[model samples]
Every structure is written in structure tokens, then in C-alpha cells.
Target: MAEHGGRDARMRDAEARVVGTVEFVLDVRVEGMVHAQAVRSPYPHAVIRAVRTDDALKVPGVLHVLTGAELEADPSVDPYFGSPRPDQPVVAIGKARYAGDPVAIVIAETTAAAAEAVPLVDVEYSELPYVVDALDAARPGAPVLHEAWPDNNCGSWRLRHGDCDRAMAEADRVYSGTYHSPSASHVPMEPMVCLAQWHGDRLDVQTSAQAPHAVREALERMFGLAEGAVRVRTLNLGGAYGAKTQVKIEPMVACAARAVGRPVRMELARDEMFQTTAKHAATVQLSTGVRHDGTIVARRVSVAYNAGAYALSSPGASGQGLTRANGPYTIPNVSIDCVATYTNTVPTCPFRGAMTSQLAFAYESQLDEIAADLGMDPLALRRKNLLRDGDVYPTGEQMHDLHYDAVLDDLEHAIGWDRPPEAAPPGKARGKGLAIMLKNTLTPSRSQARLRLRADGRVDVHSSSVEMGQGASATVLQLAADHLGISADRLVRGFPDTDVTPYDTTTSSSRTTYAMGLALQRAATDLKAHLRTLAARHWHVDPQDVTVGGGSVARRQEPGADMAWEELLSAADLAELVGEGTFAADFGLLLMDDPHDVHGPVTVHWHQGGAAAEVEVDLETGRIEVLRMHANCYAGRVVSPHRVRQQNQGCAVFGLGPTLFEELLYQDGTVSNPNLSDYMIPSILDVPEVITSSALESDDPRAELHGVGEMALPAVSPAVANAVFAATGIRLTELPLGPESVLRALDERRRNDDQEGTTR
Candidate 1:
């Protein structure tokens, strides 16, 4: 199994065998199944005085109408996010906090009738001034989005490590830049959808989710029921790019279903999906004090994450933003002040790249400016301060099995970074950029898997981790087959059913590979031990003496007379032999007592990643596009070489969207571009060659695997940005690098150069 395909087969198989998309067929045979529709608000902030359904109920198919006042449900709270200021409600009880907030739910015999009836349900509201920018919200006497929090400041955090002030004072030069990272929608191919069946004491829910168990837990808290009483299942999820981590409309769907005493299904429209769960932007200010030789003396980063409407995942994201604020540099002194502020747009959650990508755009671009000021090679300057294994972070998290230096070394030859590339014709020049990044795989992250061997010799693996188009399911199968001495085809992976599969934390954090893989590995080992026992009982030898090879259990004395997996499985007592494996979030042993860790069990903190990008800029138009990208990360071992590379590639592209494109524009708490036609993302024409997704493996014993999904994205934007600066003298502060911004920068550069009488 280890040598089957060597480098080529192991790494490319997952991409080749992508599990096809979901297929759903709705059956309309129930005696009186009703259809539902909602009429949402047109304004960002408004007070809903009443929701009248008398006109809608007159329709022939209209069965009933549902309003916030009719529902009997309690609100829920999350510890990670603070108590909702102004004390938020699940359903807009009286006032709609943000745009798209559901004030009422209506049910009818036909969906078309319901759609027609939505226009009939009358609602009136009084509008209020809203602040969408975190900075604007933080200003004194700013319109209070959440009246409970007077200042609009949702949360704040600080990290003080080493001597930052001293390092800055002794520096020979200083670099300051205020980089802006904007918010964008998840915009998955499939909008959010959920179907719930409530029968007396039980609630059975099915939906597209990254974490089904989390959904069940949320329902248990909301309905005040035992965890065992609620169930959530995922027959198929269209796509969940960190957008479906928590319960969104599942509770409402369940409540709606219970009200009429039947089943209900609801799906979000694209605009509502965009407004509900998009990655919020941040206004980051970074000041790097560097020594004469470009040995980064110190970095002081102040990051403000716009926690748009509610406290979804902004604070947790800010903490991570601070940890990665200073790229992978080996700066001895660092200080970061991170705050996630409440605004009136939309609550933010982790997207593909999350905060690291935003932070990278700031730090790495600053590095290039610093290098240029010192008249040093940008690549060489990076090498001078790159981190190695055993690096201590701002939170005292010691990174083990760190291979960032190796990744940097490997990238030089792969991306042709050794020599200078030529510039564009006349006005355009080219420069290469590189940055290293890391993310936690199991910081309060964990996964459990169950493997069963059927009497027919097939391996059935069960885990609740949803495959959000990242090839997690295939990776687990590849790992299980390798560990159990079985073929990949013989193993089948199934996921997400609270009543069936084992526990697994959310599929974000790139934790699926490390956490779920561990569970799969354990299950494989257990099955291997069980197989060995079966062989030993027949061979009349000790189980310890038995060995498994080529999917067969062999006795040391008589190797040829071994038992194949088929033979052992046939003799098993049960219809299927089950092996269960559970893994808790692991961070080696170094910084187990981290003061910043508010979650339960604690351990050492470790993350590893490296990526380099080279780009070409059309100086005449100030247009920049990446030529190729190379990446290496120590994300434990390669379970499925094919799937892992695909993951890194996907992250690289997803990361690119916000770096050079994609922005959520807001005016007075109202989202300007709530639709995709306005918000641009990288398409086929936009993606680079992506020459090498080189991986640097780290063998940290404490951690099972490492984070990979979001890590690759953060660095590329900065790399491309720095490369653009190298090509042109203009350093961009805002994102999307649109034509207007680029041309404006060019004009500014031309005027400055003319004034100085300098020519290229």
C-alpha cells in the first residue's frame, strides 16, 4: 500500500475520483403537506410593527400564517460570541436587526400560492440610521446598531510577547501601512436549505451543514430538550465553504414544521444567503520597525474586524488574525491589539481564507516596502527572518515540526525566484513575492470516526464531517485503506447523520484531514488488530506474532498459509465488525497553559505553512495577474496526495479572490453589492498556472495533523500585491485592485516621478 503509486498515484487519486454532486428528488404524496414562503425587509435596519396575514389566508391553498409572535421558541446564545448586544432574538420579534431578517413565516398547500400570498402579507416598519463600518461604529455617539453595547465594540483582545517597544526604538527604519480587507459572501453554488420533521417530543432535521452535531446541539439548547432527543442529518450538502458551520434557519424550519404538526423545508435566496453569512472585512493598521539589514526588528499590528451585525465568529477570527499578523518572520519582538467590532451590515464567519489572508496582505506588502527602502532583495530579506521549527508565537504557542524554512527553500527553485524575471514592455516591470502562513488544525478541534467491515469484505467508514468540496471523505478512505492494508476501492466513506455517525467538530480549520484522518487511522488499526486476532485464533499462535500484509494476515512461521481479509470477515460473528475512533483537538505539549485559550482542554499550539507567488503587471493599465504559485505546508502526513493538493489549490484560488478581487461594499449599514454580479471573484481566466503545490511535512508527535485549507490563501494575495509593487512603484492599500484604483495609483506615481525628474 505504501509503494503502490509512490509520488504520482498517492497525490493525484483524490482529485481524479471526486465524489459527484448531490441529487435530490422531492415526492409530493403527503395527504396535506403545505408549502411556505417569507416576505423579508427591503431596508437594512427597521422596526416591524405588525405582520398581517388575513389577506394571504383568503387564498384557496393557504393553510395558515406564522409570525414571530405565534412561535413558541426560546433564543440561544454562543459562548465564543458575546451576549447579543440589544439582546438579539432568534426571530425578529419586534424589530428586524439587519436586512433580510425574517419577521414572519407563511404556509400554504402550494408553493406557487405561497409565493403569491407573500405579496399579500402586509408589514410596516420604521427605519433607523445604521453604521456598517467597524471604525465608524467605534466612533463616539455613532448610531447604535445594538443599543445594549453603547460603543458598538463587540469584543477586544491583546497579545504582548517579547520586547516590542525596545525592538522598535533600536531599529534603523520604520514601515507603516494601513491595509484594508473587505467583506464578501460565501456564495456557494447551493443556497442554505433545511428540512425538519417535528413529531411531539422529537425533532428530525435534514440540511446542508458542515457540522450536523452542532446543529443538533443548537436545537437542544433552543427547544430545551435532551441532546438525544434532537437529530440532524445531511443526505447531501451542495457546498459549505465555512458558511454552514452553525445553525442558521434550522430552528425556524423546525418550529414552522412543529406549528402545523408536519414537515417543512426552507432554502435561502442568493441575496439573503449573501447578507446572512459573508466574511466580514477589517481595517488593519500595521507598523513594522526594521533594522538596517532588513532583519525585522519588531512588528506592531492593530487589527479591527468588522463584526457586521452579530457576534458569529468575528472575535475568534481576530485572535487568529493577531497570531498571523506578522507573517512567518522570526521577529523577536511583536505586539498586536485585535478587536472585533459590531456593525449593522451582516454577521461574519470564517470563509475559505478567513483572517489570515487579510493579515497577510498587510504584513507581506510592508516587508516589500521595507526591503525596497533598504535596497535589499525582497526574497533574500524574507530568508533573513524566516521562522524555523520551535518558533514561539505571541500567545506563547510553540510551533513544532515547523518546516516554513524548507518550504521557502523549495519555492526558490520551483518558481524561478533565483534570478530576476524581465519586466513588461516599456512601462511595466515584474517582481516576485513570497509569504509564509499557518493555521490551527485542532484548536478546540476534534473528529471521531467509526469503521465497520461487512460480511462481504467491504469497509464502511462513518464520520459526521461533511465533505464541503474539499475531498475530506476521500482522504479518510485513502488513509484507512493504507492503514488497514486494503485497497481504496474496498473502502466506502459516509458522513453526517447524528443518529448514526460519530462526533466530529466543524469541518472548517482544515481540521478534517488531521482530526478525521486520526479517527480513521485509529479505526483502521483496531480493525487490523481484530484481523490479527482472527488469524491468531485459527493459526494457534499469539496475536502479537501475527502480521498483516497485502490485505492478508500471516503467521511468521508459515507466511504462505495466511488468511485473506475476505476469509476473516466471513467468520466474524456480527453482520459487520465495527471499529470506533475519537480524537480531541490536539496541540502538542509546549503551550498547554495558554492564557488566551478560553475553551476547555488545552495543549501546545502549532501551525505550519509556506507559499510563494510571482505575477505580471500591465503597467499601462495597472492590471496585475499571478503567473504561477508554489506552496508547501507541514500539515502532518499526506493521507491522499491527490486530495491534499486539490485542497491547497482550492485554498490558493479562494484566497486570491479577496486579495486581488472580491469586496462587500456598504453605505450607511446597507450592503451595496448584495449580489454576485457586482462582487467579483476569480474565475478560470483569473487563476494562475499554480505550478507547484509542494508540501513540507512536519512530524509533530503531539498534533495528529495540521491546518491546510485557509493557510494557503492568506499569503498569495500579499505575494501578488508585493509582486505588483515590484513591477510598479505604486503600493496599493485597498483591495479588488480594480481598474479605477490601479489607474489612479498610476496617475499618482506618474505625477510624483515627474516632480522628482526620475525616469525608468
Candidate 2:
């Protein structure tokens, strides 16, 4: 057998993707298949008086036009799907809350026919007053999005530790700042696409989704189907980044297919995909009180997230923002309040780091300000307040196996934080800045795996975890092959099909590898035990005396007495061996109802990240150029070194976009830049020349592997912002620190300097 662990064995470029393969969902063709298109509303907020689909049905090749009213009237259709509160309707029912809310679905014999009929459908609407700003929505007299919620507040989360008021009063100095982060798009290469087919009483859905089981459950509930009646199979996702985790447009596609009695495909256009989901635009206010000795005494954080027209994952995102408001510091007195507000815009869902990134921009930026006030070095201040192994989080969870010191030390050394900034051109100023982050994985999750050892010495592994470009499948294969003492090629991973694979909570919150790896490990162990038992029976030896190794079972006392896996299976008269394993987090012990409950385990594990950046600011044009960047994270143990490096680098670049140039522009509750031409993302030319990253391993056995998916994102923005402040002594409190804001701040500083000089 070939060695697998600690090896750089990864699929090459030519063999990595399924673009031209038969497994691609978009390539799957069914006889008599029809294409589907959505008829969306133009008004941001309006009362839908009527939806006339007669003209759309009259189009050539148009098979059927289904309206929200028709779907709502049918008892089989579940109108809403979401967590904490099921408020998002499959389609706009009586009112259209956002501009892109689908009013009707048009099915046709050809894709072009469906596209031609989309503009023909007429929707009567009475436009109403709307609010787009999150903070404004919470104020009095703002247009109420939902009548049930009088204050236009979707939900709020709060956490309190000690006496914040007393701590602030006794402090020697206090620093406060308000930060804003604009909404951003996911921009996955593949837009939201679903192919739904109904055969007799069963429904099959092929789509680009992060969680097949979650989609299957939503489809079953919406169509009133039995447990096995709905099957969801997800192929290779182009990219997910947390956008495709929840149920989106699957129910609508399934409903259209059932109505037409034919398979239907729905793919969102680039502009329409922008309206489906987005990052929550947030306003974060942070205040910190510190003593002259540089010890952080108390901190207060308030965040308001613009959840858009509907509540998708806003409540949960807000809870995370509140929980992580204190960053990685060990402040004794801390208070945080986060609210998700209802507004007239597209619904917001988890995107990359979700609310943690936005909150870090505020909390970490405030740390720099606090350092300047106390005449302390920023890195020294962070080191002083860094959480130790025995420290407790404000949520009442105790930290264990923390590697913050190691990661921070590595990042600072890599970036040469003690050295002066690199020399810049005549018109540029150079500076270096550092930021640290701490996040907790969403807990109370569950995962299960089933493994089958074939007679041909091959193992088939089945699980509901999606491979959304995160190398999840590859990681599982490596772990299973290593445990089985076999080569990697001997393992075959099955596609995620809910009917065949075991249940898994949605593959978000960076929990797939950690939670699912545990299940796969147990499944492999079970298979080994079964193989040992079969070999013992065949050799007339005690099961305890038989050991499994190197694809063979052997007697411990007799070195020459060994039976191959194939021979043992053949003698047992069994075609294959089956094993099952499950993992359920201790929700009772880890979950807390009160934010002040600091005595319980708050999450499955704590994710830590550190970042340092060297930047050059053009004094004339206000353009910022990233000279170098270094990011370090704790990975516990890396299953695949190549994949881990790629993930860290990719996340670092992803962070650069929102830090410098990406923002979903909106005016009058309508997205102004809905296409790539208008909304800018980081290109190769925009990134730093010397980008580097590293992963830290822990000593604890249970901390064998941790999630690194979103760890690098939360710290990138703050690191850049701090560097910008260092280059020019002006604090930037908003995201996408464009040249206009920088130039304006510089001009104001010049004016203040002139006034002071004249007075002197």
C-alpha cells in the first residue's frame, strides 16, 4: 500500500473538475424537459393587486404560467421556509416586499420561449413607502415591513458579562467609533440553478446546493410528499461560500414541474441572482474603556443588520455578531446588542464570514484607536488582552487548546511588525498594521456516514456533505483510506443523495470536515472490526486475537497466518461488509438560552485567526496599494496540505474585495450595480505581491482538526484599515475605503492644520 498521510497527493488541474463530465447537473437531459423563468416585480415595496399570466401562457411553446396565488391556494404547497421564523414565501403572495420578488413562474418547451414570455406577464402593484437603511428601519415612523412586527425589528440578541457601567466609570480613558459595511454579493461562478422532475408520486431534484438533505426536507414539506418521495442530488458546486446553504428556489422549480407534468429547469440570470441572497449590510458601534496600563477594562458593542425584505438567516447572523463582538480579547466587563432589522431590499443570508467580518471591522479598528490613546503599540495591546487557555468567553464558554499566541507570533514575525514600513515612492506613505480574530463554530449539529466494503477490496463512502469546492470529498477520502490502512485509490465517494446518504445538518458554519470526519472515522473503525470478526471465524481463532492491517486480517501470535480481505469475505459468503456511524453534538451542554449564561460550553470549538499587512497610500490620489500581507490560522491538523493552503489564500483574497472595492450599490431600495461591470471584485492586479499564510497544529488529541474556511476573512478588513490609518493619521470607519473618502479626510486634516498654525 502507498503512504497517504502527510503526502501532497491532490487531483491535478486536468482531473479536478467535472465541467465536461456526465456528472454535471446542467448537462443532465430528460425527455420532454421544459425550461422555467421567473416574472419578478419592479417595485421594492408594493401591494400586489393582481397577477395576469394570460399573455405569458399565450406565447408560442409556453406550456403553463403559475402565479403565487395559485400556489398559495393549493394545500400541498408550503408557502414559507426558514429557520427561527419561516417568513420567506416561495413567491410573493399578497405583497411584493423586494424588487426582485417572483410574482409568477413561466414554463415553456424551450429556454428562449420562457425568456420571451417573462416580460409579458403583468403584475399590478401599488407602490408604498419603504426604508433601505438598517438603522433607519429601527427608528420610529419607519415604514413597517411586517404588520406583526410593529417596530420593524426582525430580532435582537444581547450578551452581558459583568458591570459594564461601573467598569466604564472607573476607566481612565474611553474610545468610541461607528463603522459601516455595505452589502456584497456571493458571485459564485454558477448562479442558482435547479432541475426538478416529478415521476409518478416521487420528485427528484438536481441542483447546485450546499446541503442536499436540507433541500430534500424543504421539498418534502412544501409538496406534502412522504419521507422518501423527494430525492435531492447535488453535483459539484462551482462555488458556494455560504450562499447556497439554505433552501432557495427549489420549491418554486418543483412546483412548476408538478404543474406542467414534465421536468423543469430554472437558472437565475446574473442580475436575478443578485436579488436572491446577499451579505447583511451592517452598522456597528463599538466603545472601549481602558486603563493607562493598556488593559482593556470594559467594551460595549451595538450592531444593526439590514436583513432586507425578509428574514432568512438574519436572526442567526445577528446572534453571531453579538457573540463575537469582543473579538479575541479578554475584557472582564463586556456588553453587546445586535439587532436584525426588516427593510425593503433583497433578503440577507450568510456570506463567507457573515456578521463576524463586519463586527471585526468595528471591534478591531477600535483597538487601534485605544492603543493610540494609551501611547501603546497596537500589537503589544493585543498581546496583553489575548485570551489564554483557561479564559472564558463572554457567552460563558471556556477556551481550551487555544493557539492565539502561536498564530500571532508567527504572523508578526512574517510581516516584520517591529521593523519600519518599507520605503515608498515620492507621493506615497507606507505603514504596517495587525489584527486578531476569534469565532466559534455553530454547535448542536449532527452528521452520519455509511461505509460499504466491497468484495473487490474497494470501499464506498456515503454522506450528505457537499463538496462545494472546499475539498471536502478529498479530505474524507484521505481520512478513510488512512484509517483502513489502504491506498487512496481504493476508496470511492458517492454523490450526496438524500434517499441513500445519511442525514447531515446543512454544510455551513465550517463544520463539515470536523463533524463529518468524526463520523467517517467511526464508520471505518466499525468496518475494521467486522473484517476482524469474519477472519477470526474463518481461521477458527478468537476475534480478540485477530488484528486488521494492510488490507489483511492476521492472528497476533502467528505472523504467517493472515487472510486477505477478499478471501475472508468470500469464506463468510457475504457480498460486502456494511458499517454505520453517527455524531450528535452535546446540545444540552453547549447551547445556552441566555446570553449571560457563561458557565456552559458555548460552541463546538473556537476558531482563531491573525493577520498583518503592509500598505502604501498614494498621498495625491488616495489610492492604497497592498505591498505585502501575512495571515496565520490554527487548523489543529491538516488532512491535505495543498487544499488547506489553497483555502487560506482564497479566503485572504476574498477578504481583500470587501476591504477595498466591493459593495452592492443601492438607491431608492433598488440595487444600482447588479452586474460584474458595476460591482467590482478583487482581481490579480489588486492583491499584494508578497502574500503568505500558515496553519498551526494543536497538541490535544480531540483537537486533531479544526475549520479554516472563514477564519482568515474576519481579520483582513481590519488589518488593512489599521494600516491605512497608520499611513495617514485619519480613521476610516466605513468599508470599501475608496479614494474619495481618503482624499476628503486628507483635505479636512490640511484645513485643521492650517487653522492651528494661524492661531499659534
Listed per candidate, the RMSD to the true structure in angstroms reads 4.1, 2.5
Which candidate ranks first by lDDT, i.e. highest?
Answer: 2
Residue 480 deviation, candidate 1, in Å?
A: 1.2
TM-score of each: 0.89, 0.97
Position 442, candidate 2: lDDT: 75
Looking at model 2, residue 662 earns an lDDT score of: 92
lDDT tens digits, residue span 345-407, model 1: 777887776677778788877888888889998778888887766766555655455666676
lDDT of 2: 0.84
Local distance difference test values of all predictions, in order: 0.71, 0.84
lDDT of 2 by residue, 302-360 (tens): 89999998887786767777777888889999988889999988889888987899988
In candidate 2, clashing pairs total 1
